[model samples]
Target: MSRLFPFHGGLKTVRHKTESNQQAIRPAPVPRRLVVPLRQHIGAIAKPLVQPGDRVLKGQMIGQAEGYISAAVHAPTSGVVTALDQRPVPHPSGLADWCVTVESDGEERWVERKPVDYHRLHPSELRNLLRNAGVVGLGGAAFPSAVKLNLSGHCDRLETLILNGAECEPWITCDDRLMRERAAGIVAGLHIIAHLLEPREVLIGIEDDKPEAIAAMTAACAGTGYQVRVVPTRYPSGSVKQLVKLLTGRETPVDGLPVDVGVQCFNVATAHTIHRAVDYGEPVISRVVTVTGQVRQPGNVEALLGTPFVELVELCGGYQDGVERLIMGGPMMGFALHGDEVPVTKATNCILAASAEQLTPDRPVMPCIRCGACVDVCPANLLPQQLYWHARAKEFDKAQDYHLFSCIECGCCSYVCPSRIPLVQYYRYAKNEIWAQEKEKQKAELARQRHQARLERLEREKQEREAKLRQKAPPRSEPAVAKPTLETAVARAKTSPAPTLETTAETVNRDG
Candidate 1:
């Protein structure tokens, strides 16, 4: 048995997973209109490839990946492009972004797919293929899988590869249901990942709360030298850093990634997508979503990308009477959505229609008692109290001094705080402020550089004009034959005036 290590400070929150994981994954009905956002993944938003009135087939690339860190966006079904304009998307900020709205043709026609023999292709080719296929982590991070798969500068060789099935948050069971039903496909995808990475060992981490998933994954991993390790049921264990610590006993650097610790982690859903993309030539047009809480039928659905949250809720028999808020992801880390009309993206894993009973009561804020409750439960082992104080004061540098970025926004501190303070919100605010300041700095620097370049260009042009004028100037003609002054002319005239008329007549006769 592989030795498992424990990490510091985690909460044993209520697992409301059974509400959604009890049934098999259902395929969601394609909506009449799908509003797919171009900014699904973490990096640059994808560039739109289709415009209004263009007909597109299912699995067609609708948005091309824009950068090395981005992923492509594909058509969820055969459709006609209706609008490529700014529309509401699923984000905590409640902002609109550029999206491709498609009206389904009801044909479900697919573009011709060319599945490749991954083993024969170069690693770069395979990664590019995955990028074009829109493969990204489905564990809510939605990081491009191609970027993670490339282990270029992180280490000499990968030591461990962890497939995260530890869907440890409350009321989210998309991953749990995926593992229970599609373990084989996931493992097959794992094989492709292993082929590319060639890690020394493979470990799948599932929370102990998910026995069926554990058993299913274990069975699928048999004979493949991959081990399914059931970690203790703890809040935020599904987090990459915490899961890495639990599985490998290695600490990821606060300023670095898991690969910096010679480990790489991928969501099991991501691996399954890899399998579909490589072996089956399918792009990531859909994902399994858990829709529960204040709904008539709480279950998991394989929802197409851009399917509205309202549609999924309706599919699950719509909302219950007392539905107070619509949240994306789980209660611990998820944010409440502005409305259910927002479209699902690659980052969406759960649609929680929370009621007053399901949500924490809106308790009045109280002064901190300095009881140290938050410190005791912080999984990252940071001083959350200090962070909160600094963040609330708008002392962003002080918050950074407290290692605020290391907090992971896991909400454990907020959960344990006696003051009922929304500590996470303050941290998020501070982080955003800091980011905005940095962007302003970058813009200032860029403008300064441009001004300097313009000045230099003007100076060069001025010098060139001076040089050209000098070259075009006429040369002096031997001092202009020394023109006589008035005095010299008068003196010369006095000496020769007596014979002037005679000389003039003689000169004229000689010339004639």
Candidate 2:
């Protein structure tokens, strides 16, 4: 309804939707083997409840949630556990993490399940049910839904819950197809959310280009309180902040979430997963994925969690030719995989087998010509050049002040950069550094607490000794000298500043 172009910086990159969107979503034939990762969901890495040589049925819990913010992992199909160890996953480093290898049985048997009448249950009961079902944000974030639903009573006057259907990524058609085909199920899930938040307005934001999805969703909400809002087709329109502004004209503050602006957004695919979890009592064991790019037959496939990319590619007729790169998700936000051995986790929305032409063209480094193209397209309104300068200089704290975390690493800045700088990589490096620092800070805080507690114990003992001495004899008239406090004793014992154990260890370890 309002002007769509409120932001200054955005890219008009090539849209490669024609490759997969033309065909209706086809079920990806079951693979003979599925490599299930234990830590598919966010928060804690799940601990395997089943070991090698154990038989597991489809939808059965194989890995238990590790901690409060984790989700359980279910068997994608009836299979026997073949292996459980570190294996390559879909990450930028192509690094290996803990995973479970399953040898599938062709029968596709499902475990026993009982759906709950969610309407009659309390909010906490519903939240617990969703948590046990292993539901998480289906968007690339992969955040646990239960934790988000149970936010600290900071959310007041919560008005709207937005369903993001704007699969803005060029090659990812999973969400788009899901909405078009399963609109009713998604709407039913919306009702579930409505019950939880009791928001008067529920806006389903889909890109204008997705006419079929919009029409289907509109019809699906015919008698319901939900409202379908078709937004302009724009890159990064599906981003939480961008979509919020587009739908509600509210600009969220820096370092704040959608809840800060009286809104909560969930991916449309996530809604469908909620429907399946609440209605059928099924966990998030599998999801729809768009496997496209240099593959022979590019299309959408409902893939089991922890499926190997190679297996998905094979189902799609394999690569045609000149498959120079294998990326997970779209070219803009996806990470390039070293091989197809990486498993499809809950976070993976697509597996892109890109050729030289489809992927970013490899070019020599160029100098910035003060083009200001990058700044013109940044969704976060951050100065890309300033971030790059600080990051390259290793000024991490300064980068944080510039809202480096806000950079979604959508590749828009790098996409339009005349100099072709790897801007996102720098931001990633800075973010990782910040996280590492935060961990160190937390450890230091814990150590301080322990030291304080020990000091308190020692002081209590000294006080008890003095009290016993006084009780045994007449109290001295002279004022007792103030016993040296912990700080005083430590100061008297050391000539110089006392080095922390960590610092001393690092110094010794480095020299050694």
Candidate 3:
């Protein structure tokens, strides 16, 4: 029996996962138009490669990774650039961001594909290739996969590499289905990651609810020396820290990452993408998304990134009558998006078209009565009530003092809140405000540094000019010496008359 490291607190919420997992995965039809966002993944937003009116082939690089931390963006279809402008994207704030609009040509044309033996190339080269391929964490964190592959910065030796297959979120069944259907691909991807990290042990954590996925993945890992461990069905177990703790019993520090504990994690989908990128030379053009909840027929779709949510909903037989909300993920952690026009990005795992009669009915938010319900259910073992108080009062620093960043925003607190305080929303607002303030401070500091540099440069230039003038200046001429001539003698005698006058005055006084 695998020794289980149980986490502090979690809920066994209603798992509405069967509705979507019952059907096999299908490819979402390429829409007529694609609104690809530039800043899909975490870190810097990708730099656009094509302007309006430019032609692009599917899988061709359209947006270059801004830096080492960013992932590249690609064209999902062969199309003409209709517009490069800001459009509404899938953000909690429902804000508009820069998007590359492409009008599809229906050709589905692909760029040249070149598979590489990653072992033959330098590790840095392989990472760069993944960056160009636009591979990132597909389990919704959307962190650049290539950046995580390197373990040298984290520790001297990696003891474990975990592949998170625990699709613990209630409505999100994308990872579960991926494991069941594409187990070999996921395992192959894990092998590639092992080559990069060379971890001592590899483990894939899946929840007990995914029996099919667990069996499929276990059989797939038969010869790979990787273990597929089924964890208890618990909400938020799929999260990085919790999953790591479940599998390895290691607690990532207060403000640290998984790597700090001699462990690293990758989403199973991310591993599959890495495999495809290295083995078949495929860029991350599409992903499997779960379209579940109150639709006529719900299922998972291998959707091209930038496919409209409306098209995806229609693919699932449109929203059922009396649909109240359209959420982007599970009802527990997901945010309710305003419209379906928001294109899917790497982070989109599930699109829940919720009906009025479904789970988590709209409840009136009331004042907190100092209840400890949120604290008991917090998986991170944080004091949710204190964090909520500080956040609601705009004491962001105090919230941080209570380890607010460690909260994971899992909504467990709000779920158990008797008063329906919307605790998670308050935490998110505090986090955003803190981030904005930090960004402003950074900008101000950068500007101050630049201005100081400019002043120093001007002063240096002025000093250099003065030094050059002194070097180029002519030497002063020596004072002309008076020749002992009549003119000089006369001038001297006139000037010396006062000395003779003193003697003459003395003689005149004697004569008187």
Query: Which residue pairs overlap in candidate 1's backbone?
Result: none
427: Cα error in model 2, Å: 0.9
TM-score of 1: 0.92
Per-model lDDT: 0.92, 0.83, 0.89
Q: Could you tell me every candidate's TM-score relative to the true structure?
A: 0.92, 0.86, 0.88
Judged by whole-model lDDT over C-alpha atoms, candidate 2 comes out at 0.83
Q: Give stretches of model 1 more than 4 Å off.
A: 463-512
lDDT of 2 by residue, 1-512 (tens): 43443444566556777788777777767788888888877799988888899999888888887688998788999989999989988888878889888899978889998798898898888888787778998888888888767646657667778899988888888888888899999998888887888776888888878888889999999988678888777788888888888788888888788887888899998899889999988889888889898888898888888778888898888998899888887888888888888888889898888888886677976876768888888988998888888998999889888889888788899888777888898898888998999999999999999999999987986677557555543212222255646666556447434334434465456456
Q: Report backbone clashes per prediction.
A: 0, 3, 0
Scored by TM-score, the top model is 1
Arrange candidates by TM-score, descending: 1, 3, 2
Q: Summing lDDT over every window of 10 consecutive residues in candidate 1, give the lowest-scoring window.
A: 472-481
The reply for model 3, stretches above 4 Å from the true place, is: 446-512
Error of 1 at 266 (Å): 0.6
